[model samples]
Target chain A: MKRAFGVMNQHKVMNDQDVRRALARISHEILERNKGTDDLIMVGLYTRGVTIAQRLSENIQKFEGTIVPVESLDISLYRDDVQLRIAQPIKPTTLAADISGMKVVLVDDVLFTGRSIRASMDSLQDFGRAKEIQLAVLVDRGHRELPLRADYVGKNIPTSLEEQVRVRLIETDGTDDVVIVRSGDGNNSNG
Target chain B: MTLLLSGLGMVITLMVDVESNVIGSQNVNAAGTNRKHILDVDVLSEDEILNILDQTDAMSEVLRRDIKKVPALRGRVIVTLFYEASTRTRISFEEAGKILSADVINMSSSGSSVDKGESLLNTGLTLQAMGVDVIVVRHPYSGAPNLLAKHLPKVSIINAGDGLHAHPTQALLDAYTVRSKLGSLKGLKIVIVGDVLHSRVARSAIWAFTKLGAEIVLSGPNTLMPVGLNLVDGRANVLPPVSVQPDLDDAIRGADVVMALRLQNERQNGGYLPSLREYIRRWQITKDRLSSASKEVLVMHPGPMNEGIEISTEVAHGGRSLIEEQVTNGVALRMALLYQVSAGGYQIEEEHPNGQ
Candidate 1:
């Protein structure tokens, strides 16, 4: 509802080079803040979050020569907006390593209203208590509905209410880019 | 959770002194089985079957987790009110309920008040009074689950198996196992051998697989095959394109899956077949007969297998056999069914805009 709606035109904000640089800087910041990767675990949200986590883990491995474990979590059942969807199919949540008493970083592709992160926090309650939990995102689009913030952010983009922020990874979408597509008020999309 | 358990306590207290045979026969309209209760596979649409299979795949993931449990049906109470003795279906339902953190209570007709003349309707009302969320019932009569569902309006009823009528859950797990082994259920030729007439498993399997687009060939003796099941209300009863084949080799040729059902000893005494020896010679599923089928064909059997009668021991315990996997999938399938029925407003139906 912000402006003219164009479905065909997509404004690209980040390319492959920008994504790589952002991930490398985030890895350095994580190591510096945590004072080395001791008892560290990376958990990725399902779909795009998992791919971003693998990229971050690989970057950390290259920088510190330490292999970090990455797990994928599907928070479909924990989402507060489940009643609003057509169907809620709870996907697989594979955690190869237990996160008890460990420093865990939750990763996702795009962070908007932060409801998904909130759902992830609720889901984490059953997987044992983590000593510390942190949030990381590739794109932090402004307009968070929740009182939550990401500790590690790749890009901060200010967006209007009618705009949709989509993060596409090569593994899933066969592309590495972030775009903002404006839509009309006739169509309503969820974050 | 405590409140539900306390309510269960109230149900136990309400049943003080009673004992008699009370499985009264009521006039249940055949069409009454079309309610939300999965009494038989005939009531299910193809989309519903696919949806259940998808949900079963999701439930299977819980088995791989360290917790191995979920709170999807927490605070919900499910009673496995089984009239017949069944170790697999009962234990699997209990396990499924426990994994979903549902308060599960096992009630058998043997030691229960049903032996003391407590009717099915009264027993259902008693459980409904205690706020039971769902009841998984297996009775010796054909439409027993439908009867319980008709009497109890508040609780969901799942038919574990009701006489020769339907075992929808068993059919579901079998479909899941086949979908897991093969990529899809569409256009696959499945040969169901042995007793089809008395098998609730075969009836439900035929209804389920046909809905999922699988071509079914019912292979057995003329006396042992189901009659009057070809059509219902002028439409194909168990879905169309189902053919009846008496020759074992012709029926199994080019088949992707061969399901050998358990041969009932009662069939022999009823004059349906000559003897176990003649039945094995004519219809037993051996590896040699399976040579005409696909090399990667799967062999399945609903358990308590008559090793040498319906299926040879080697084929039942062969590499391509998914009998054990079917049993494992049973727990997960039941978990999905229980979660779908117990969790209010969850998927598996046309969602009401009012969210009832």
Candidate 2:
């Protein structure tokens, strides 16, 4: 199966095993940076990031033997897609956590244009005064309209604007795989 | 208390939120009967609405934090004639009547004498002799409440909703909802979406919201939104008029408030909309559609939501949805209206045996 987002031209073709390794690495980095999960939180961007954050929290629970709080956000109201195409987007859920004086990491599936991240950052402002906020993503696609970047990234895939990146996972797509796709025009192809 | 006898039922209630022109200014009875936008906030200045809501809040406390009863309106009898089947609005006035210690009588015409071809006029005249204080009425006809209010004397009329004409109580709850969320209604960009033509809440909301100095944008498919109803009796008014928008996204863009009225399926039969799927695809408050507005935008709906159809389940349940708050505010708003109409005229009596 193909990743929901196709044609991610990162360093190499990552299988499900490679994706798992990347998550573990990212999880370890989050654990090390925060020192401990004492006052730290992981917030996911609606549908996909929710799973990513939950998986990372589970990984952290293995060593700490305690669960870290993870919150899911439905940024439909804060999405950048209002005037654009009509898509039945997912609604996000949030957990009531006192975010003050805590480390917050906002997770998303893809980082394209960075507009979504900017919106997510704005959405979190209403919840409370957070001491610190960080952004993490699986793939950082570089055609950013907004001057935003992820603090933790699984991979940076630089590709033509037209190329689509697909990240497939068993938890979602029933298979684990990642690939970049052509524009089907034959002239514009991702190797 | 001075009682005026009439052929129709008489109702006694408090008077609140009555906006008359500049103090001592004369009302020149216009050329023809004018239709006032009861929900527009602009007709009433911001201060007026703020004052009303503040008063409404105080009146609300009487019904909410108390023992569900008030001596403020004792010795009053009000007839609740619900021509439509509804749970929320019907019970609100009933509760308001009982709370104020008024004799509450309900007449649902399903198996009543109305089925025997008795006109509304005859039933109203018959109820008049019963010595009622007020008539809280809901009728399917657009001008039924106003007609009843005109023909009847002694009894004040509280319009729960009159067809697609105006649902004043619902509008009051909407005003309460916006006030609860924003703490104020002045100078906000409020957009109303979905079936504007058939939704009385939309019509009433326009009046109440406009009265509070908020800008209103009526947005929906051209077929669903009938643009020319903002005037008093369909003529121009002193208030700022409602702006029309065919595109939902543009209407919601940078909007401070977005209220989605339910899409009535019956209008489609009258060439009002193309299809429900098309309407949802184009106008439903989708996730992406929400981001067009500023972060502070509020999403509201009068409940029994269509879920994924009119509004997505996610957005409806999301943090922005004020649906529950709207329902909660309904009881208090109706109570406030009742308090005003029922007890407004009740001045505390001083100890003067000869005054009576």
Model 1 DockQ reads 0.21
Encode model 2's per-residue lDDT on B1-356: one tens digit a residue.
01101201211121134334531011111211111112223234455445556655644544443234444455678788888877877777788777756688998878889889888777777787788767777888776665555565545567777777778778778888888778877888899988877777787788788777788887777656654443333323332367766577777888998998887657645666566767788789977899999798889987557788779998998988888777777776665555444432322122101111
lDDT of 1 by residue, B156-210 (tens): 7899998877899999999999999998889999999888888989988987898
Best by TM-score: 1
Clashing pairs in 1: B19-B116, B20-B115, B20-B116, B20-B117, B21-B117
Q: Where is the poorest 10-residue window by lDDT in model 1 chain B?
A: B11-20
Tell me the deviation in Å of residue B162 in model 1: 2.4
- Chain B TM, per prediction: 0.84, 0.80
Q: List where candidate 2 sits over 4 angstroms from the true fold.
A: A1-191, B1-48, B63-66, B228-239, B344-356
RMSD over all Cα atoms, model 1: 11.9
Q: What is the TM-score of chain A alone in each candidate?
A: 0.90, 0.84
